[model samples]
Target: MTVERRVGNEKIVELLEGVSRSQIIKQLRPVGDASSAQMNGGSDNVVASFKELIKRQDETIATLNHQIKNLTATWLHRKRFVKTLNEGIEAERELAKLKQEMAERCQIENDRKQAEQPHIEHFRSASLPAVAEQWQQYQIAQLPNAEEVVVQQLSAQVKQLEEQLTYGWQSFEVQGASLAQTSAQLVEANRKIHDLEVQLAAAMSNAATVEGARSQIRDELRKQALRMLDAMLRFLDFITLDAVACYTV
Candidate 1:
């Protein structure tokens, strides 16, 4: 059986044994008295003594029963107290575990924020201002007068190169005898073509550079937005954890 049941049974057995011993003592004393009374020819006194012994045994049984009741009540009270204490200890353990988890989460968030601090500063101090300046410059370059001037300059150079190349071919065809002069003109035309190509390539490279800058700006903006959202989420989590801790307390 269970430990409590076993202990209660042991106590009951001990009490019953005490009652049996007391009954045996009373019985023996009365029997001895009756034998002496009989020997003295006192039958009435023997009967009266037997009645008194019975009354005393009844009183003793009642007292023992009362003591058993009191002991049982005390045992039950102690059992309840111990159970309540154990439940309280378990609750304390659970609370401690929850608090530890909250602390760990808070530490992780703190570490993440610390790690991102440099990127945040860089975005604010360098990336943002640089993007703004580049955007302003791009806007200025897109103006009607400035665009037209650039286009016209490139077109004029192309046209001049084409005219020089046409003149050099015409000279070579019409003045075959003046080979050296024609050769010089052709060389000059080739040089103009190469210069024009170089200028075109440079323009294309500048356009690519501007595009790359814009892409970098966009990427930086995206990263900053994500960081802001993460920070807000972390703050909300911290507040929630704090509220939970307070409520648990």
Candidate 2:
């Protein structure tokens, strides 16, 4: 058997079929004609490459997950903002309706002098002057000082309602802006993540193809090595058979 001992520890023996001697024996080996020590040290390189690939894949997945989570959070935030705005709008509408009803009732009461009505009986007190009480009490009345007082009260109420509406509008605008900005950010982030994943997948596929080609080349090299070893074994076999035939003759 002709053993090609390139790497010192490796024992590449004859690879004849059904032979007593074993074939190639190597834990790890470099393809090029490098030292055994160099080959042994280089196992770390393959390990490092695999680790890097795994790390990249993990990073890509994590980035994509974070983007998706951020988008979902933004969606929820917008939903809550819209719900709150709707509630505020409904409340404002009810307040406006109440104010309108109150104004209408006051107008109806003032259209005619109805002092004897059951509604105004409790609004007026016995100790107050008739005109003074009438002026101070019913939001609707015909008096010199009544219009100013009514105007002041209505103005205050309207101002308060206006302020509330303004606040609601400002809040809505701010939330809407936040939603728009968040949505845009989410979209951009997702796009970047998607691009990264595509790149990662392509790189991994390329790596796999390269590894496949390398494996095929290695297999062919091993086959050639085996054939060489087989020739060596056949030479030893021919000598043994010739010796046996000569002894028998």
Candidate 3:
């Protein structure tokens, strides 16, 4: 029984020494100092890289947002320009319609005057002479008031026809000037619309370029993140090895 107790104590002491050695090895492991320095350096490098990546991403996002704002502004301008162009076109059409109506009315007036001109001249040259001859034979002294009344009526009709012709000519000239102005305005609107279209196309191209740049930045960031993850995995593997070594010791 005493031999058994002695052997048991020796086994217990051996176990205790093994446990102590494991504890000592764990405490003195190379995870500190040089190993920790390397790990910390790697971690710091990874953190710095991530910070740089985040900054670059933030810059990229800001640029993208700025580009979006510009694009939106450009689009809005294009829309308003198009709307104005359409309004201009509509006004031009309306002006053209007015001009056409005015022309038709003038043409009708001219045709009526042309049809009446020969009759008016015949009445003045032929009928007036005949009436004057009849009045003279009948003796104008006996019917002086009758001759005066006929002459006054013919003179008044001539004055009225002249006034109408003058007014028609003035109105035609005004309409002509208005039509010319409308034509000029239409041409200017078309030119502006064309310029705006060109600008819109350029803006679209710039937006595409910005999108491509953003895609490249995202791809680069993803690659960097993957590299950082691989580096962390390697660091973890190193730590695991150290722990295994301490256990074996």
Candidate 4:
């Protein structure tokens, strides 16, 4: 099959003559290294390919219309098939997206529930000590000897709370140290991401420069091959519909 593209004549001829899997891989490597957006440019070659497909589709319809001139049924049948196929594909894609969204929402809810659990336990533990002390102290009997001796419970409670505060400060310091380490890791990760992005951009630019030169040669050869096919058909009156339909020419 002849390839039609917007590239140079001589370069097109050279590449087509020597095309290989490795050569194609060489063309693909740069796209792999490129940014998602820039790789899309390398992938524009795909969109360009679609242009030819669309053109050939038009040619096919023309041939069908010309050959089966009496019946409009075939034309309508082809149109309906293409429409139904496109619609089915679109519906499937939408359904997949909705499923993905629901999965993400469920995951977020699970995480929220997990996070609340720890705080719930902490509150229960804190309340248990105060309630127990209140109940037990009320049961203590008053001292004998006609006068009741009063005990200073509030001072002892205050001292115990101070000890707990000291430990709380210690726990806070340990968490603060962990946060400092995490911050350092985040900074390093950002630096690495930046470096990879820069390298990817450079690789893309280099690949584009190489492809530009290589594509020129491929175009020239494909265009000539197509022209030759057309010329051969013109010289002979036996013009087969296959050339117009399947043949790139």
Better of 2 and 3 by lDDT: 3
Runs in model 2 deviating more than 4 A are: 1-47, 112-249
My TM-score estimates for the predictions, one after another, are 0.35, 0.29, 0.35, 0.26
Better of 2 and 4 by TM-score: 2
Across 129-150, the per-residue lDDT of candidate 3 in tens digits comes to 8998887757755765967866
Per-residue lDDT for 1-249 in model 4, tens only?
222333445644543454455445555664445354554554465556556666776777677656676456677888899999999999999999999999999999999989998998998899999988776555444334212222455567677767766755665565557556555655665565465556555555776575654454346445555655564454332223323432332
lDDT at 144, model 1: 75
Clashes of 4: 9
Task: Compare the candidates by lDDT and give the number of the best one.
Answer: 3
Q: Per-prediction count of colliding residue pairs?
A: 0, 0, 0, 9
Q: What ordering of candidates by TM-score runs from best to worst?
A: 1, 3, 2, 4
lDDT of 1 by residue, 1-249 (tens): 111211245543643453445454554566565445443344344455556655666776777778888888999999999999999999999999999999999999999999999999988998888999889668768887877776777799899767766765564454444444445655665565566556555555677585665565556556655655565565556556545644453
- Candidate 3 weakest lDDT stretch, 10 residues: 1-10
- Candidate 2 global lDDT: 0.60
Question: Order of candidates by lDDT, top first?
Answer: 3, 1, 2, 4
Angstrom error of the Cα, residue 124, model 3: value is 3.6
Predicted candidate 2 versus true structure: per-residue lDDT over 74-138, tens digit per residue: 99999999999999999999999999999999988877557546556655654457877666577
lDDT for 243 (candidate 1): 52
